[model samples]
Target: MSAFPLALPDDAELSARLSARIGQHWHRLLAALRPLYGEGAWEGELAARLLGAAIARPADLRALDQVREAAPDWFQKPEMVGYCTYIDRFGGTLAGTRARLDELSQLGVRYFHPLPLLKPREGDSDGGFAVADFRQVDPKLGSIDDLRALASDLRARGISLCLDIVCNHTADTHDWALAAKAGDAKYRDFYHVVEAADQVAAYEAHLGQVFPQTAPGNFTFVPEMQGHVWTTFYPFQWDLNYANPVVFIEMMDVLLYLANQGAEVFRLDSAPFLWKRAGSDCRGLPETHQVVRAWRAALAIVAPAVALKAEAIVGLAEVLPFLGEPEQPECHLAYNNTAMTALWAALATGDTRPLSTCLTQALAKPAGAGWLTYVRCHDDIIWGALKGVIPDETLARISDFYAGAVPGSFADGQAFQAEPGAVRSTNGMAASLAGVRDGADNAAALARLRLLYGVTFALDGIPAIYMGDERALTNDPDYAVEPDHDDGRWLHRPRMDWTRNGGPTHAAIARFAQLRQGRACLHAGNPARPLLTADPALLAFERADRGGDRLICLGWFKGDAMTTDLSGLLGSGDWIDLLDGTDVNAQSVAMAPWGLRWLVKKNG
Candidate 1:
């Protein structure tokens, strides 16, 4: 093992540099892996493989590794705004997306997450989540070379490219799955395939339905494999068995391969369901955190520039472990699902208590990690995640209100995979959910949109703007008519209309971005502290940096004018509203209908 040759540059200095990096992180990496894989010859072999991949890393990426390692909190900066879109819907292809970098730059976007462009099963691939090939790009989007070129172009313009790497399952058509179907015992062990029906039932008892109405069960029996394969999501997506050490090795290699291709971030899709244990919910288990920590350690050694974001859309308690403690860091970022769901609940009920509760709980995150805050994304707004934080009846009412079932509701959204007596998930574009429609009050709708985005931008995290939301794009009317897109989530996944730009909605977002820039108080390192107010309709938070710079953010959810006393919160300071250059009376602050304010000490 000691004599293993390293595949590095001919320059002795470069080889020594890479060797020292391995030496620094090797103990941490082994510590994370030993509990999962124990003492074995495979450990030495795996280390050799990882070292080779690190040496083979591209020169430009190595340079990036040095820069990111120097400043580990680059992604947590105040100016780090994210834009997410599909390659085809946004710009038609990778080259087209590269050409439209100007649009992203205008919105002050520093992180770009183009929705899963990886190759998927030919038809009905769960909207590209069912990845058939991790190494290849979806032909419709472009080739792997095109992705590399796009990543290079994005990096040149100070943007980090984020790609989704589905960690829990793979499409049945994937090569490994095909090999399993071909009766390869070694490859067959990559996934959980039970030969008995009772065993499947035992596991199903602890699992919850992901798409109860659409895809149903947690196991699918295949005649070719002659067993029931674990399918937590869809029948065509087989769940990987992490009990097998080889599976972990394979996925870690995939991360390094993509990092070398200039991809700066990996969204670990379906991350919480990685480690499955019999007779347990099998979500966010201890083994899952270990796997993520090991991956983080490996990235620290090989490509320190690459960061992982967990797509753990569970409750707040379950989500925190994914953002591990500072001593043993897991993912660099995790989705703020609790706050996202609570924000919607507050808007519907005209009460900010639930949102305040969630934000207060969210203030405690790992020092090195940040939250991925957003107003809307590609997926449905699942209200079920807020089960305990919000009352069941309130969740139901909010869900119905967003689904347009409530009387006089301005929203025109649809319920997704809803079951009777269950907390419902709603789907629609941001503008439509904000009440933009044919006969609605467009001014109020635009204000609602601005108000929601204002809170997201002011929060302590990297706020992500879903595609087409900046222009206040409404729901896709023809979504249901599209082929294999009957899923209601597509309603919000509208194509970008580049021709129709510069609306009031777009202007509002640009203004928020401008205000967010260069403000140390808004940095992710400074957590937002939720403030209690007398009015339930007003949501308030204060963000203060180490340098004594303080910013108070207020969002009024109701459609009527309201005033709240902020003297208690903003004591002894003459504050000015950063949104509009107006002096704020600390004793009595007045808010317009659906108003938002970012307050900072005047001339401090």
Candidate 2:
């Protein structure tokens, strides 16, 4: 894997080829880095050192590399479904997770993304996103050994393990941060340190507050270091100074270290905020993209089997850069947060205009990349990404309704911050926000949940089930009493009920999996076009394969019975509903309060 291995592998060609890759990728890596680290810096030396570490990559993982290279598009198939959750919430611990492999396999989930399990600060660790240690697992979740064991079990069962690697900042308690406080000049340079108040003001002028209610600003004063440090999210999370080549080298090594531990995919958290400069937005900067590209190059030479997933939740225009240009790709997969929120807006307003606009604009990806699409994930659903797509007045109405500010609004959601004039982001369980909750009509709630989830699966991408989402799990009222109770996102990040609430949600999930799997038309790589049926209550999309297999998914979210003419959307060819064995005709169709129709090829 490197030019100099302690002991070369028995296979001569493999060793020579790997050694050659180090030189092949080094120039690109240095070219990307020289802008930040400069020509005199040890960026090249650090890059060579990283290549040296690759020589130690486990043999088993090397074997996995070959399996992946042979079928690189394995993740783009229809059968590649993803499920995301916390290790503790999903299954008590790593050992407990292994015990449920059979259940996950039965659900047809091939990609399993466990939320941050890395060691974090003592309390209020931002749900483990604040990492205190790069290599250790949170003791509450399990030991590193347990994680490796779980990963091994998952791999054997044909599932790929996707883990989070928080790349933006480290907890103040991280070794590097602690060393800085202990008067180490080298380690002190690891963080962005400003000695004067005006130095902080310069960066703040262009940066917006990430946590306006809690953290409030971009810099925090650390008395121990006698300087103000840049902290984009929280004061306890110290941003790294990527201008220093050592910081880049260390983080890159940590990424490779985790990949060797059996993680097939690494979710690079806060990808846009990696690099910062004064008098700039300090987000999605060119330097950040260069850093990501350099890391991707390093990964190519080290662990080609693994993939990097971008976790940047910015506007559609800004997000596309993280995927890199077609010639030089950065991430292999990225979250379609734009679509995730658009789906919610469409469901809340019963209008597809907002959702359709988003799809029409930036749904396309690089040739080898795909989006990780989900109805809900472990975060507050913010509307900033769709600011222009949805009208401001419509945005207010939808936000208010979902925030439970409107009368008769069934969504029991909580605002992340109830500030007077700020854009209010909402957080709640997907089912609860979709009008599925207690005391309401159980039948309607079930139907709405099914409809929303059905659209999620029907879309052209890797459909991800937020662990408890499939069970139609609602907001957790009792989450307010937990140790880290202040964060409203905890309401939706509830522990899973293995019972699955009598399998109502489970049945629908399995049904969708069964219908979507083994269908090339449903693959993430297939062409998905928004069909303008001119129906306000319905959100329609048509997915088609090169082989002519087609699927038309329509989800009725108006919560009222509707009979609409769908004749304009269809040709003379006969189409059949896949949900129920019924023929779909050109005439007006009747839909229940919250129903979904999956019209497919007559014989499909």
Candidate 3:
């Protein structure tokens, strides 16, 4: 069966280009796909689809591809900073988003991730992740044409536009899902629909609930389909069946289509759950990695400029596979969820041991890939990522600390999907989690926020600033009042108050950006080495490039002032604090409460 209706291009140049790309990447593409599809008609069909997408790619994007190929390390540079926000929250519309590019560029953001704006189900669409259509932009956000214009505008400002591609599932109202509900056998194969109760029980035995309080099961009974459809997160989202070759072809087409529309990077949301095998936990399976690798190959062939980012927020061991080995590279970037969780843990416990352990493991990734580091994102701070690093009881204690359930707790955040006697995930704005509120202690809260941002910026990755965090925005007190927005994550996903100017927290972030931009040692390729400190409340690390450039980062998480000697770590070298223009003695370094320092060796 032909995967795409289009034939070979009539233009000789286009044909030659397509053939050349196929020749160069065919082996790799096949090596990734053959395990799933094997030798058959699927090969020719996928080849045709790949060629069609390449032929359809815009000339300007092709030029951009060449530029990116020439500079493969473009995204791994020290200057690469990212900012993530929602279209509706950041800007009222796509054109409105264009007006805000200057603000993003001013913050040193080269990568912008406007959270999922694709067409979704009518109500409770899982924050636009329940995608109904891949090609269309949500009308409320803007039209597809508006997205193209915004993309062009961002490119003009030296920023890349990143969009989420929900790889694991689709809204039940999606065209394919609708077709399946209407009893189309071929379309029904697009999803996993089990008619037998034993089959459902078998799969459920190995699956864990994503939202036990709201949506408790992994399968939803669909009377129209006469079976129970797999729903990992929510009942309205039908998990795609990747076992079918057609599903892969359709999704690849969607990726190419979006790339042509000027999406420079794709956040592969729910990446770890892409494949399923009975009698096993259907998360981070080997088959899932194979599918991601194949998708990576497809993008490399058609849109080399477009990069894939894995949103696999799982344990450290399981998360590393998504960023495949150097020989068979997968994602170009992945969220350092383990480190993000560990940071929160350290803040709650005033112990950097767990954070150091996570950082030490995170220091190793594929050569071309980089970690996406952030203080807070638009989702809950799932403590499960720190399961192996921190004990369950400690994780529960930290969770309670963040929820303000502990005595004298500085944080004022809400718990998400928490069950009694179990460690719960936390949800709140970065400022609120850092203890920001209207009170006499606001200064200390602001300082705490600065310390977190400072550590994030100095890390060996592209540091992302969530929208409104710079302004020290606290939790939206009325988030739960909105219709279909009861999710605790909405507490952090607040609307931007453009009328208000940022304060000290904002200045500190901009300063961090300026300093990070000039430091060659801070490049993502230079893995950060965790420095062992005798003080438990003090977190330290060093980033040293091959050219002898080095930066030692130190942060004091305690509320009271403390002093530590850096002689052991600095080796008697004359060091200067980059954050403030102060000469520092390696033997006697004093730190104020919630203090951060970026130390660099003095120039000869």
Candidate 4:
């Protein structure tokens, strides 16, 4: 079954230039699918369906496409700042979220990521990730129309709305899953189903557990279907079989449908697990990139303003493929997961080697691509992304420290599924890990938290601040006891205390916002170069653009004050500290415990 050299028909609604853009990328899509599915009947049918979607794209969205076509690098510009939160937590509902635009405007948040607002399974929805319906918004959040209204209002204020699109799986109660259970031949092919124990055992040899504490393995037996279904994350979440062309067309339609509702960025969740093959790790596969690029092409044909953000929380080497080489662009933005996990590792060990290594890796991103960097996100912190940067034994120690297994470890984090032979993930808020919950680290937790956020702000990528981190919101210890919510990730996902926030952290954020305005050095095009420091506890980096504007960022990971030689990273110039107005002489600068420094070249 060869699926290459397929004809993707032109859409009548598309302008000649837009149709030509489709013509340019359609072959790349065919080239990707041919090796995976072959140039057979499936290719022609999928091409027709994709063209139909392009034609059916809303007129309003096509207008947006034209506007953004004029400003191609809008999202990549320096002023982009993101905030990720859940609607039920950030606001009571979509209407409430709309009412809070003043707050987002006050914080200068141009990119808003409302985490997983889509409808999910009735019970234990994996924090809304096990999507039951792609087009509907969660009733607890708001209606679909409310989401559209909120998105419109956000766009008017120069903010881009981001939503999560789960690509790998759907809830067991999803229409397709239900149809498959009812013996619908077409729907059954949408998911991976193994008939025999032997088949499951064969795949088990190569499969790794995503949630060992609860889900255990990759396959779950469904008696009604009379076969074992592939459930990568949970038994309720069935992994979609991407090898099937029908599944591809249906999901591509869902993407365009949501774009018409005003989503400017789609966070491609679980992107690494999209394409599965036997005798392999079944992650970050070549087919996976093809599907992403194809989706990118489809969006370009319909709504060019929207961007895809890959959530491949894997090792740096594995993540490189997701951000395709500059010429063949895949995701416009991807998560800086290595630096996120390495930040915790560095804090646990007070050694900047792994953190510095992660920074060095991120500094080498493709020209047109940028990362979504944050202190921590809604999920657990897995140690896999930091594998090569830190030794295995040391990583285990850091894990133990965050998991509360090590003595004097002040972080009140819970380890998820640390079975004797299983890889563990961790859960805890940044504030709790920084000792804010119990006032550990001599009551300097707030300062320590500020230091981390400062580093995140000073970095070259789009800095995203999670809901709780800005206010020093501590962990919710009650999550472990909550019914149907034993997942450790809820520890970090606490409800927003909107009234009590905007303290020192917010003040620090305001200062970073002030410095970022009109300063082209903060743009994503500038790579964050890791700066070597004489002190092992200080992590520093230099972010400078081609235009010669430079900013040097320094973070003290240690609990005690330290003075270090700044000559290595600092150039010959009168540098002004942007964070604080302290004047430092040529070669030496002293930092307070858990302090942060931002030094800019006196004048460009």
Candidate 5:
């Protein structure tokens, strides 16, 4: 079989345009897919159909094309700051969210991630991951018009809207699932349904459990249909079968439908586990990449401004493949999972070794690709997958250290997935993790808060701050009692404590962010090797662009007053500290605990 092309019928102009752009690298993409899809003539024909179908909506397609032509570097801007929150959690509804544009702008946030507000099943919706309908917003949030109005308001404020696309599965209550249960043969092909338990057992031999605490197995037996259904995350989320071409068309249609609604970015949730095979791990399969690439090609012809961001939190090696190259590039952006984990490890152990080591070995992205740096979102922090780098012994010690299980532990976190012999995830607000909640010495807590924020601001790519983190909101006490928020993650997802604006912890965070804003020269600079210092507690690096503008960012991991020589990275010059406007020698300098300094060389 020859590899399929992205060619839809009745789209001659789009076909010609795509053919010109993809002509040189078409054969290479086809060769990679031949082994999995089979070398048949139907491959090219199917590809043409998908491509032609992409441009069926001429008006939406043209608008996207215009964006690509005008601002290709919209994502690479140095001013990018992301804020993630649920629509209802932030304001009250979609229209209410639109009412709060000024609040987002106050924090320098230009990228917004509102978690799945789509219509989902009434019970145990897996935090809206078990999607019932892809196109409609949940009535609890607002109407479709409300979403469009919010998107328009955000766009006018120079902000980008990023919504979720649950790629791997849909809720068992979805139309396809309901139709399949109704004994419709066409809909039955949409999902992987096994008549006998043994077929499920065969795949279970290699499949991994996503929620071992809540839903242990990979397959769930639904008595209503008398068959075993594949559900990796939860019992209600049924995995789709990509073996059928119609599934591809249906999902692609959904993707285009959302782009037309003015979503500039898409969060590709649980993307790695999309394609499955027997006797294999079924996660991050080669077919998964093929599917991602095909989507990329289709989107390129239709909505070029919209970029796909993969939410793969696995090992660094597996994550890099999702950020495809010039021709077959998969995701334009990916969560910096390795870096995110590294931050937590450093915070608990008070050492920067693991953080530096992992970043050094992590893969580099293509020209247009970037990382989305975040400290904490509305999710639990799982360290099991980082076993080797974050040793199991170290993790156990850090766990107690963060939960105040150990003497002098600053954090007051809750335990999640705490089964015996199973490494657990951590849940707590940034303020608690930074030592503000447990009544540490006032100066000590303030110092720790600044240090943590300092590192987050200096990290590579766009820095994203969780809602209420800027105010240093403490853990919510009522989530455990609330029926809707029984999960541990809710402890970290506290409401905005508007009264805490000028409190010591909040001031420390706001000042830290202010410092970051002053040094856009470093955050926006090109990727460069970090200059290592002898002290394990010190994290230092110099960011320089091609034009020779350089900025040095140094932070002390442990909140301790110490002095260190910086001549190695400072290039033997007198530099001005942007924070205090004091001239200092780059040869030897003293910094306070958890203290940060932004320095620029003084040109004579």
Candidate 6:
């Protein structure tokens, strides 16, 4: 039984030297940093020491100079819109991405998340999640100079570049893994390699299988190494052992190294699984929180401007803990997984009961922390884990409903990762989920699209649009033919079709986006969880100034002949409906099937 060392050795003299180095660079800012990190914290002191070491090294010093002048609260903004796309999918490479800055700016996008551009092991790189070399870019995605130039261009346009720092695991072909396989004792200490099957069995007993269809075990047998290597996601991607303090220091070096590369925000992929313990699920362990806390402490001390965004794709209960207290920080922003899943589920069921429940129970985000809300992303939709709160039978029905298996269902989606017992994840574009792909050119499809977009825009976090979703791009049937995109996610990850720009659907999208863009109520404003005045058929909420002005959004989840009267919520007045150019009385406001009315009180 090898107990992992959790702390570093004595370095008080080294701390003083590092503090002086930082003081020399940032004399004025040290006053603000001292209060946040405390007088003498290990993480704070270590970050300065690491910064000093980085400056002495033969790498570029320009990033360090920029760090000294970086803004403290650059992430906090009302109009911050995010755009996530693969460099190859959006452009072709790093330089190609530089060419599209003007287009991204047209969408009012201030933050860009280019998915995993780092070097990966050739055959199975888990879509670049399995990082081979943390220090360099994928040769396929141009050089470090291209990335530096792109970052400079993005910064000039007020767009922050967000990159993935895959903290969970590294590719099997990484130098450290290769060394460990060749009987290098020092390298073996870098990862969790077990000689005994009993230890491996203990971990597997409590651990949840990530990709149960493909990778079955928590630990994989690496024959070349003649040992069991911990592989949480896949056999080729070995998990790094954080029990060793050196691993912490080393990964921190990787983090700051990238931050210096002009990365304003780091999307910490699979962050919840950083630490593992026996007799536990080995996810979101106490040590995991501590490690993240240590990283937060380090960032506050050195890079006050750079923010840590967590990618924890867990249940609603486990999500809020990532956003720690303002004084002692964890992550600046977290993916709104519960709300995202709920939105899909709501659309399928044609009832906002689940959506309302999620909003009421699970939407209490911390003051300083923000939520990155989106309809879809590059990952598979994880369904069953939240089954404890939402029943398995309900989840199965929802899955079937979206897959077009259930009769009279509007959604035209394909199921991914379908297990033996009817458990599955759904994949489709926003338009497909709205039933527009089912050859409908009528008002029903348009109404459904509006219903989806209205809920998306009215949600409590930052709204994100999947690249061409604004123009009602349906699922691409040909993506399944390609080997790399065979995993049904490509059903939604289609190329931007500018040819359809002149169509009626495109005009509809433009109108919706115009409404979305004009709403000051939806942008960073706290909307009260809509108290359902009507039946489960209608969902309504109010984003109020709380006293002076109010913005009310009402939508009918289903039914062709349903009506909701909101005279109780809105006392009296003729309001302007942003969806249609009509002044309607609040006393008898009626909406069509799948119709949404965003009413804002008008002043004389």
**Against the true structure, whose lDDT is highest?**
1
**Candidate 4 stretches greater than 4 Å from native:** 1-14, 40-48, 55-60, 418-423, 438-443, 480-482
Error of 1 at 444 (Å): 0.4
User: Deviation in angstroms for 557 in model 6?
Assistant: 1.4
In model 5, which range of ten residues has the least summed lDDT? 1-10
lDDT of 3: 0.88
**Could you tell me every candidate's TM-score relative to the true structure?**
0.97, 0.95, 0.97, 0.94, 0.90, 0.86
Checking candidate 3 for backbone clashes, the offending pairs are none
lDDT of 1 by residue, 478-543 (tens): 987878898879999988888875588888788888888889898898998898888889899999
- Stretches of candidate 3 exceeding 4 Å from the true structure: 1-17, 418-422, 439-441
Question: Residue by residue across 1-604, what tens digits does model 5's lDDT show?
Answer: 2333443345587656566545543555455455555666645554555455455545644665677758765665666778888787778899988887777777777789998888988777877888999999999999888988888889888788899999889999999999988888898888887878888888888877777787788888887667888888888999998877667667877787787787888898999998888899898988898888877766665667788889887777788889877766888788877777777778777778777776665537676677777788787777764667878888888777777788878787877774448577788887777777534455676667666666666665677778777777778878767655676778887766556654664454445445555344544436534668888777776666666767777777776688777777677768987666788787778888777786778762
Scored by Cα lDDT, where does model 4 land?
Answer: 0.83
lDDT of 4 by residue, 1-604 (tens): 2332434446454647555766676677666667777767776676666666666666776778888989887777778888888888887899999998887777778999999989999988999999999999999888999999999999899899999999999999999999999999999999999999998999988877777767788999999789999998999999999999888878988898898889999999999999989998798888899889888877876678899999988888888788788667899999988888888887888888788888887766897888888898898888866766777787778888987899988677877665445347688888888777644442587887888788888887789988867778888878767667777788888888877756787788767766887778888888888888777788888888787888888888888886766775686767778888878654877889888888887755
lDDT of 2: 0.82
Q: For model 5, state the Cα shift of residue 154 in Å.
A: 0.9
Reference-based lDDT, residue 237, model 2: 91
- What is the descending TM-score order? 1, 3, 2, 4, 5, 6
lDDT score, residue 30, model 5? Answer: 56
lDDT of 6 by residue, 94-193 (tens): 9988987876776667788898998888875778889999988999999888887888898788777889999988999889889988889878888998
Q: Using lDDT as the measure, what is the rank order of every candidate, best first?
A: 1, 3, 4, 2, 5, 6
Pairwise TM-score winner, candidates 2 and 4: 2
Per-residue lDDT, model 2, residue 157, is 83
Number of colliding residue pairs in model 6: 0
Candidate 6: stretches off by over 4 Å = 1-49, 53-76, 385-389, 418-422, 438-443, 502-528, 546-549, 559-562
How does model 5 score by TM-score?
0.90
Q: Write the per-residue lDDT of candidate 2 for residues 1-604, one digit (tens) a residue.
A: 2233234456686677576766677677777877787776475467556656667788888888877768877778888888999888888888888887776887788899999999999988888989999899999888999989989999888889999999999999999999999999999999999999987887788888778888788888999999998898989999999888888989998988898899999999988898888889889889999999998888877888888899988678887788887667788888888888888887777787778777776556775787888888898888777888887677777778888998878787877763335467889988888777665566777787788778888876678988777777888889979897778789898888876563577788878888887887988777467888777777788888889889988888787898887878876677788888798776767777888998986876
